[model samples]
Target: MITLKFKKFNIEAYKPGKSRVKKLRKVIKLSANESALGLSPKVKRLISNKKLILDKYPDGKSKDLRKAISKTYNCNFEKIICGAGSDEVIQMICQLFLNPKDEVVLPEYSFLMYRIYSKVVGAKVVFSKEINFKISIKEILKKVNKKTKIVFIANPNNPTGTYLTKKEVLELRKKLNKNILLVIDDAYAEYMKNSDYSSGLNLFKNKDNVFILRTFSKIFGLASLRVGWGYGSKKIIDRLNLIKPPFNVNRIAQLAAVEALKDKKFVNRSIKHNFFYANKIKKFLEKYNIFSNTVSANFLFLNFEKCRYSSNFFYQKLKSKGIILRSTKDGYHINNRLRLTIGSSKENLKFMNTVKGIFD
Candidate 1:
């Protein structure tokens, strides 16, 4: 047999969240933290453009897409870079900054992709403890040292759905070494109505080391398109540009995202619906004795820690009934918790009723 070799087991493969199961006739998918209101109708209208050329190469820089994102968000156009998703942009950061033995700091239960990409680039991952399901600034500061090169914080953290206030974030920045890159992954930024939260874009003006990673997949309802963009200082932008793959973001995704940004009405509708139904689900769950920690994103992290049954048991039970919710096992590292994305009003009601049937 030919010898099989890898980088001596450099990385464990990533486990993406579960997709909606399709066997059942009626299904309510609240697993992935995707928009309860799907893709913008304007984006949907663009899908039938039959005259567009299919075989042409996309603009390698994705200039128009970047300009649209910049104009919509009041950001510097030249400073933004697009990727297949923010996930690819994140991996590029790892490749550009991480040496064979450098260390990257993260929240104890932040996004799982950060850990996976760090390991692939031969970097060590350091996790800071969370306080009451929020990323604790004190714990994160304590984890820093001479070896630390990057600190990845996913604001309104996935699975947990809690966020760090802007004051706490700026304080963390003041204490950390300026040499270390501070990456803010703001995937669910638009869904948040928290008045004290900022997206770290303003932080980039005064701080040489701040970088913001954002995704069209979340609030834009373009999850299927896999388009995302990043903001940073010119030096960081240049480095990432040189390292990213050619035509990394496809033409279709770029076009869809550009349109997604133009339609603020649809985005506002999604935000309103998410806000309304998410709280509705929260109250319903509380009535049935299920509770969650404070959440500021599009999902809920149900506290099942006190229950006799495992999270897996609840996951499988819901799966059997055609209601899909996320078990914390997708590498978020928070045991005894289940994350359920807020679906449409009808979907949310069905999910809650299904749970009541099981437990009540």
Candidate 2:
């Protein structure tokens, strides 16, 4: 048998929860930050009509989808590139920009994909310290060096639900070297309606060194479809396109994403539901002395301070009750914090009631 010398990377320390629910058991899944409202009806219709085309190969150019995305954003078509998901785009970024000895900078409690992708390209990973589970700009600035090649920022950051204001981001960008690539991951941008907060697209337009990464996973409810795109200068996109595999995006995903983009009604409804239920959850938690920041995203970062059990213990308890939530401890070092995705009013109520019984 032929064997390669590449050893598997042990990056993400995922803790598998034991499932207590048996077949036919009803359970609420609020662990992953998925759009609980479900996918767009337009996507469903498109997928149904395109089922017969699966036998054929996908369009290598992804021209129509690119056009749709560019038209929606009012950007150049050449500057937009789609991938299987934003995760794939992250991997492609590492492959394109990182060298064996180059260093990558990210926040300590940020997304795990940044570190994983950096390591895949043999780049050294440097982490900035977390202040209340939020990335400190000062810490990031201190870590920057001549050897650093790329910096990743997740706005309305995952797991923490904390985001930097537009002013803060622009100030940070000013401090960084123009040579270093700054990636702003805006996976939850659609849910944010703050006037002070930008999706990083403004930075992309103003600075050639910056790029914005977006996803259909959260707001568009296309997580299962694996559709994501990135925007940057035409020069940067051209370089990325050189290494991107032909037909990187499949047919169904391209069609579904196009339809999902036009489903403004579904998008608005999902955002409204997220905003309403997130506030409800926050209010419910506040009565018990547990507090979270007022985030502009679909999820809430629940703190376990003054709770009877540790975060892991509480996680297990919640899991035993058929309630699943995302915990940040193993690789993230965010102890006593749980990231809860905002679900429907009923789902949110169920989660709140379950927590009330355990904590009260």
User: Which candidate number maximizes TM-score?
Assistant: 1
Residue-level lDDT tens digits of model 2 in 1-360: 997797655476544322235542877778779987989888887788834488789887678989988888777788888998898888888999998879999998778889988987789999999787777889999999999999999998987899999988998888898899999998998899888998787556656789889898899998888889888888888989999988899988988888888989999999889888888888888786667878579888878786556778878777788888877765667778887888877888888899889887
Task: Please tell me which predicted candidate would have the highest lDDT against the true structure.
Answer: 1
Model 1, range 1-360, lDDT digits (tens) per residue?
898787843555666666667687777778888888898889998866887666998887999999898888888887888999898899898899999789999988888889888988889999899888788988998999999999999887887888888898899888899999999998998888888987777555446688899999888888887899888888888988898898998888988898899899999999999888878888777765578856578999998766655778888889888888887866665677899998887888778788888886
- The alpha-carbon deviation from the true structure for residue 117 of candidate 2, after best TM-score superposition, in angstroms, is 0.8
Pairs with backbone N, CA or C atoms under 3 Å apart (clashes), candidate 1: none
297 in model 2: Cα distance from truth in Å? 1.3
